[model samples]
Target: MACLSLDLCVGVLLLIGLRCQSCAGSKVYSSPGASVALPCGTRVHGPCSKISWKYKEKFFFFRDLVESGKVIDMKMGRLRVGADCSLHISDVSFMDGGQYMCYDGATSANTTLQLLNNGADEVFAVVGESVTLLCSDSTSPGVGESLRWSWQKKELITANQGGDVTVSANGKKTEFKINPDSSLAIKAVTAAHSGYYECSLFNDSGLISIRRRILLHTLHETTDLPSAPQQDVNFTLTCSLTCAAACDEDINLTWSHSSGEQQQGGAVVKINNTLISQLLVPKSQASQTSTCVVLREGAEIANHKWPVQGGKEVMYSTCSVCYPRFLTS
Candidate 1:
């Protein structure tokens, strides 16, 4: 009986040493909406007939306890047990941050998952409004991970030519301007700013700490819309537009007058930050419908028709003041 007890004690000590040497202090970091793998301890050998992944006592991932390579129940579809008995989680979230226990029938291995919260999908800002793209580091602040900011903008019109913007810790930009904060900010947004932007945080060693893709959209403002012009006095049909945040001046405005009226001086003017255009026509011709078009890079952003009747509704009158005088004579 004494010899049997000694053998049992030796077996327990060996198991403890194996677990410690294999994966006692495994730690990994994963960004939000990403995937991560937790390796089982080196002590785990032999065909993995059964595997389980657990948080605390709750089992979230289970493989064939009775058979090999068969999944019994997986609480989330994002979970998969690798052939090496590792736990691979897809689309990881902050809620997934915790200690994960991996059981390989005889013994278990544990790993710590740290989830970073720097993931932004889309951002919408009115033209001329300021916007900031967010990025954060989840690790403890004092852990001394030197972080730097890098921004890249994707061009929609061209597939080959691309631009990049980088902001250092001191708030200096390489090509474009950005806020000193870890977030990238655009003061005045324009249609040119509309594109896919990638923001990545990297350590001084050039390793990526966190990465996120942002789709930035800028809104255009079409205001002070024209109403139907009256048929009497000399009328001025006007269209006004607000300036884009990016201060893009590659914008054009034009007025299309009814064909019945001889064309007059129709001019576009910039008043302060607003683009205004006026079309002056004689009272007799003003009643006819006209069109106001605002275009940016050949794309019409604002199109309006005055006096809904449109140019097609114009009716030309053959008789004028001179004709009446002639008839009397």
Candidate 2:
């Protein structure tokens, strides 16, 4: 039993030694101005051994910094190595993004030093116009793996230019056709369509990176409608607010007839953000009503009245008169 216990202890030590030998510490820096550090460490089995650091394929520093405390060459001048073999480089540049190596004579380790540019390409398109979203890395397009484009309505995914969609991401060249040109071609442009759209790229290493965002805006024309019903012939009154996109919610439409009759309906039945209110009076109940009120969003925006029979053909007009004192009171 004692021999078995001794063997178990040896096995545990071996496992720990393997992990320590393979462990590599890594740190990242940003491009256009940042710095990073790479730690070189061992299990401390014996006395501390020599340490070395390398950037890309060139050696930047050695154990000399621990004893001499002096800068080396141009790139190495910016680096500092501690007694424990940790490397530090200040004022990092775009070219500094790449592979880094750290060595402790007992065991050597390598780490990736990625200097993210983080500057995304700007993509813009006018409403009803076609636009292409591009993704780029330090390397040019058609040189890497594949690029992807995706659109979302708030948190929900609306369109995908890759996978099921017909987006092609060959090498670094990724392209997607916006059939109708606009994201909201089939659906009208509404406030809901105004959100963040992301374009990304996937490399051979299976890393997904975002490229840019596409901003969408829709322009629309505005009009005023009546707020109160006119005391005219019993006719249906309709009010509509049209835009490039569908409304997020049903429009609230209210109808007010001078005869103390109030009717309400939603815009859902109109297939658009439009309201229709009918105040029917059989030919027997026909009366000389003067006006009809159309209330939208709880505000009397417009009013319409039956045309006074003056000539052979009736002419309609919009009256800008104020609401009666009795109604306000």
Candidate 3:
């Protein structure tokens, strides 16, 4: 332990009887009002029975969280250590943003928790798929507080002072539920659910508005399949969505083949409100699966799988006037 430093290391050494080693910086990200588990003890060689943890923030004092496998100061009952020696925290608020250290008798592991800004303003959903719109805030609603979630000025759900939330029927998309963390979950999403969603709070300080404006784009997919691809036979898959002109910046649709090599890719076509992505799949590797995937922000949000099974050998389409297709890009 560094004796000169007045950090949580000193607090743990004085309060608990364990020595902490050098800090290993690891960054973990989570949204506000969400639960997170921080990993620890990757360098330790022995058993992880006597684990202890400490916390510190940039502008705040260090805090001792766990000692001898027990929580010490989380009076709100939100901190616990999992069986894997990782610290779990629920309903995390912005005030809880800090660095956490997990230590054994000799060595230690450190992790820094970064609270996301809840950039969940716009959430895209697939047609017939369930979509969840998060209502994240810097602080969890306190007791005697109430929250009202609205869509385009229409009431969807409300949680009274007692924390019992009541979801009301709003429009055609009726199925909805508020998760324990105050996020609203809607089932079987459609184009009708595309609009602004707002989460409002009613407290002693009057109506405190925590507004979340969201735009949901529902992707519609269709594929021509169940016909196994032979050597030269070809089929195309299409995925389309309707949105504003600028909405395609973060969304992508593509078809993937089982083998590393691709046979052909069709040109993406946009007609007014609809954007379509089609792929010409060739029978390269039979007994494998091909997929049509949708990506947003470089992350796959939806996919449709088509298993390619070769039935029998077939010859390529050959005509004296026909020419081989080529990629332009």
Whichever of 1 and 2 has more lDDT, that candidate is 1
Error of 1 at 153 (Å): 7.0
TM-score of 2: 0.27
On lDDT, who's better, 1 or 3?
A: 3
Instruction: Tell me how many residue pairs clash in candidate 1.
Output: 5
- The sequence of per-residue lDDT tens digits that candidate 1 reaches over residues 248-310 is 577766665556433343566775555667776555653466656556686544444555232
Expressed as tens digits, the lDDT of each residue in 170-261 for candidate 2 is: 23322234332222221223333333455444444332334444443222112222244344433333333332234334333344444656
My TM-score estimates for the predictions, one after another, are 0.34, 0.27, 0.44
TM-score, prediction 1: 0.34
Better of 2 and 3 by TM-score: 3
Our model 1 lands, by Cα RMSD against the true structure, at 18.7
Task: Evaluate all candidate structures by whole-model CA lDDT and list the values in order.
Answer: 0.49, 0.39, 0.59
Candidate 1 whole-model C-alpha lDDT, 0 to 1: 0.49
Model 3: how large is the Cα RMSD against the reference?
15.7
Instruction: Name the runs in model 3 displaced over 4 angstroms.
Output: 1-124, 158-174, 204-206, 211-214, 226-233, 242-252, 260-264, 271-273, 283-287, 293-329
> Could you tell me the lDDT of residue 260 within candidate 2?
51
- Give the Cα-based TM-score of candidate 3 against the true structure: 0.44
Which ten residues in a row are the worst by lDDT in model 2? 320-329
List clashing residue pairs in candidate 1: 128-245, 188-245, 188-246, 189-245, 189-246
